[model samples]
Target: LSSSMYEQIFDRTVSVKQRDREVSSFQLTYWINWHRNRHAPVRVLIREF
Candidate 1:
């Protein structure tokens, strides 16, 4: 996804997450494997990897 999309996700998710006590910080991780020729996989940062 583009940086613009990432920015939106960052803003929206943070507010929703604040309602819960389990969350600490926020992070966005992505990987592009063109060899697979499929969509990228994104993992939202949780307490663990």
Candidate 2:
């Protein structure tokens, strides 16, 4: 997917870095609540530069 698509899916706009470098990051969260106890949702972060 393109940058526009990434921005749309992540709900944020992407901007170019001004210091002659670029960085991209994303986060995803999910959970399964089939057990009896409550717990925090799993989260993952992806980064590319």
Candidate 3:
């Protein structure tokens, strides 16, 4: 999804950092319960205006 400048979207400001670690993370998933389905996993890319 496309978003606008901070003036329009930001209510506050903050910074975040991740710690380096060696770990095996497991993925949890479930199937759709409805009729419609995804053809494949969703994809993202750099948006050019």
- lDDT per residue as tens, model 3, 1-49: 1233431222121111112233212211121111013222122111100
**What stretches of model 1 exceed 4 Å from their correct place?**
22-49
Clashing pairs for model 2 are none
Candidate 3 displacement at residue 13 in angstroms: 16
Candidate 2, superposed: residue stretches over 4 Å from native? 12-49
- Give candidate 3 misplaced runs (Cα > 4 Å): 1-19, 27-41, 45-49
Q: What lDDT does the true structure give each of the candidates?
A: 0.41, 0.27, 0.19
List the pairs of residues colliding in candidate 1: none
Weakest ten-residue segment in model 1 by summed lDDT? 27-36
Residue 36's lDDT in candidate 2: 10
How many pairs of residues collide in model 2? 0
Best by lDDT: 1
- For candidate 1, the lDDT comes to 0.41
Per-residue lDDT, model 3, residue 48, is 9
